[model samples]
Target: MTEGKWDEKFVVFLKKYYWDDILQLANSYPDQRSLEVDFYDLDVFDREIANELLFNPDEVMPSANNALQQIDLPVEKKLIDAKVRFIKIPNKIPNRDLRSKHLLQFVAIEGMIRKATEVRPKVLNAAFQCMRCEHVTMVPQNEIKFVEPVECENETCGRKGPFKILVNQSVFVDAQKLQIQESPENLKGGTQPQSLDVDIEDDLAGLVKPGDRVIINGVLRSHQRTTREGKSPFYDLVLHANSIEYTDLEFDELEITPEEEEEILALSRDPEIYQKVIGSIAPSIYGYEEVKEALSLQLFSGVAKHLPDGSRVRGDIHMLFMGDPGVAKSQLLRYMVKLSPRGVFASGKSASSSGLTAAAVRDDLGDGRWTLEAGALVMADMGIAAVDEMDKMSTEDKSALHEAMEQQTISVAKAGILATLKSRCALLGAANPKYGRFDRYEGIAQQINMPPALISRFDMIFVLLDTPNEDMDSKIAKHILKSHYAGELSEQRKNLPSSTITQEQVDGHMEVIKPVIDPDFLRKYVAYSRRNIFPVMEDDARDHLVKFYMDLRRMGDGKDAPVPVTARQLEALVRLAEASARLRLSNVANMDDAKRTTRIVYSCLRQVGVDPDTGAFDVDVIASGTSKSQRDRIKIVKEIIKSVGEKHPGGKAPLEEVYAEAQNQQIDRQHAEDLIARMRRSGDLIKPDKEHVKVV
Candidate 1:
């Protein structure tokens, strides 16, 4: 109960079970000034000792510190402060679950590190010298504000005069502040995550980086929040970290029950696992089987590789969907948001570069200190980011993703802060065409209001067209009607005072669009697979990819021509195959996985990059706005117009004469007309009148 008795008890408890560990720590002092002791170890030694520290941390912590200082060792070197860190607390609390009752108690909280401030020194003990009598007094600083002696300590000079702080005689320690938020995977439904501020001191400073899933053991303390209106009654809670440890697997943050783990393992062994998972992607949407299948692979991402040359290759697959309206692009995006373990859904229309990556924000959160805020992409690290209306993003905002997509990192150099944050998430973007509808005759880059350079970064680009087909339309109508009916029934049951519909009746109606795997189960399955499975490429799979690339390259070997497919697509194939292998929970990607992925990639290319004139795949079609054939025709038509204008005395070419010249050059009149319109749109030519044009 008393302070000295409490200190003696801590010394006795440490000597009983940790005498050898203390000797080892003393031997390694200064070099290893901290001794990490588990709370369970103390509980096993004496449960009362653990309980006393957890309830009365303020008194017990210093007792443990004194016990460490009192340990005798053979080394002649004086030990610089030694720390006893208590870890492995059995009952760890979530960030959101921390309550007012836990104040001043030793508690363990688990979450992802969202932001961290730079390390700074805080004075702990200040020695002051009074100018009146040269008397010295020591003051211990406890709060955020510095402390100074009020008067001289000598009896002869008890003056209330000024005293100067002895800076050299004062002791200081490294301190850091952190913001930890609950991991996205741990959240259910659409619940926003809760965060708490933490104050780490001494050796614990700078031990963590942003996006790290860590379990921190510390005492919960409260500080009064000071507002512009002056000191408020509300107190803000912050954890004073005593020990920090990284969670072994990112998936560990998502607590998977034993029954759920069994179900996941069993599902992995199913032969129809891939189809079932794809069906579970966006079941409410009528069709887009290919798109849903690709999204399924996105959930089970491939393992990233780090080469010996100090370079890295990202394994995340990036997909872009450019389509007409009412094609369920937004619905699919929202579904992926729930499927991926840490997915973030953001609208490109409202997202800025700083909102998607990282920002150096100056706010009252740190009392005017610049704080680095983690954005959507940084917070969704090792997960998926689904951006709807991707075409609506500003040019500068879209450019921020170039490095995040490829290098899996965001480098910030604003407000005198230079820091790189991890953003290793797969991007799933959906955009609409310029004219609000997909144009099969036009290039994808030309149809969408996005730069060619940004468009080419996507691993696969699919064009979803809303074409009228009798059979497809019937199926879509039935699917939409069933979805609407199910929704109406659910809403009616909720609104009615006394409902005739039983629970069984409601379940039967909802089962029509129910996913093969429940959302919760699918989340756990994806997390387990991502955390445990890292597949390798089999020989046959490797050969399959190699032959596909070689065959596409051979198509460009006829003459001086551009390559049909770049090596980027090859990497995409590998990532897709590995994801397929993960669905079966296999360590090696086989021929079957390779065949499925190859077919998917080939389909994507056919949809977006195929040159209609040559009937061959052309990478330039997607990388730039036009293929070689289209570019050549545009050149020929421009030359003809230029030549016709030179022949004319007025320096203008008539539309009819330009058409005739294009016809003489073996160009179709209709094709020439389209090219002329395109040139006008691009500002390459000026239309003086309906019948005539002038070269710009």
Candidate 2:
């Protein structure tokens, strides 16, 4: 109960468990604001003492603090109010698993900080002066709201009258509130992560930001909810943080052993590594080898570059798969999400603009202050985001991703809170064709419900048409049949008694539908490659990329022709080549890597950016509404419509006559109708009747 007597006990406690460490700390403090004591050591010293310290932290922590102050230092090194923190409890609980039994008991909790409130000065001990007797009473404020002495402590003057808080004598500490949520990877099935409030003060305040995974040693405490009706029976729990620590390694949530790293490195050295990786992704989906290869490279992305001029070149490759229904596009996206270490999967139909980027929200989590919440892209920073049903997203929501795709940043300027958050994630987006089926004659961009500007941002776009080919169809059918059989066998085995299943039967099923590499191994491999490798473009690779770009541009024939490609494609080739090199675990992209990526890019361009009639690549088809050939056709159609409308009555041209004239001009009747329909959609022409169209 006495000040110096408590200091003596603290000294004895320190001597018992940390005698040697105290000497080292005495030399380190003032420079170091705190000394971390392990709870295990305290528990080892005396179980009852540790229990008392943890269960009654308020009474015991001051002794620990006084012990720190009592340590003797050199003449010039006297420390004042140096903090003593406890960490590394024997049993740590996950944020979602906290129970009522732990209330007021010291516990270690682990989670990611989802939101943090601003640090403000909170009065810990208030000095109140009684108006009647001028008696000053020191009151400890322990509740959520500040408290004052009910009556003057002076025995002679007992009154419930007003008392002014003595500002000069009050003790305050910087305090902040944090909402810590269980990490997503820790959740089971479709369960939503649980969250709990944490109160951090003094040296621990402002120690973490949103998205940082941390472990905190604290006491779980609860307080009754206060409302207009007065204090209610409902209680809310919070962890009063004592000390906090974060993982030292980036993305340490994904644990990989040294042996696994060796296996990944060995696998990369194989000459057939590329093919193996491609085969590993969604192996049961059968076919789409080119698309699978592209997805493989996307997992091991290129090295991001920051030039001296303060501009950045992103190394993340963005890929889009616009295909027919039942082509397994969503399956591929889900596979990639499982493969990447920090992958985030979202559906455009369900995700909002703020849900996909970042939003400034005012909520109780921040105590009514505006808090910046990270979206899927931001949460997937330094990794990959797989967005399925991308075509279904509202245009307003799609606009939010423009800056995030290229610049790798999301800027929020709302609610007087301006901030820029890093996305830095490769996007693997899938969408169904707008018409519910692919049209071979239509440009890939035209089939998707996305703007040209957004379509052009993707580095590679693949169109998966579900054309009936007896040969390929049989292969896909066989693959699907085998996959279904494997699933059926798994379920049947689960239902059967132990004697009914045999290892031979399980082996038979596994052999029929197994990936070239296991999913867990693939994840570890990707993590290893991304964390260690940063490939640079070799001279020969650069030459090949430049030559490829120039050759594609030359295919346009002349300046009047539509541009075959742009600088964006050039960057894409480099990124893909670098990714290829990373896949091989090489530091330099060789000529082979360049050639492979060039072929891949060519395949993608021929699918999405080509003029189907001319059989030539035209970037305008995807970047702009019309290509050169299409533009010329539009001009001819406009002329024919004008001539026919002028020759006819009421500015209307007969549909049959227009088709006949179009056929005479070397255009098929169907092609002519398609163009006319497009023109009508563009408001260039109006159909007065089903049989007649008028020039607008």
| Most accurate candidate by lDDT | 1
Candidate 1 lDDT trough over 10 residues, lowest sum: 71-80
Q: Per-residue alpha-carbon lDDT of model 1 for 281-324, expressed as tens digits?
A: 88898778899899989888778999999999998999999999
lDDT of each: 0.85, 0.85
Clashing pairs in 1: none
**What would you estimate as the lDDT of candidate 2?**
0.85
Give the Å shift of residue 172 in candidate 1.
5.6
Best by TM-score: 2
> Roughly what TM-score does model 1 have, to 2 decimal places?
0.78
Q: Residues 632-661, candidate 2, lDDT per residue (tens digit)?
A: 998998898889889988989999989999
Least accurate stretch of 10 residues (summed lDDT) in model 2? Answer: 245-254
RMSD of each: 6.0, 4.5
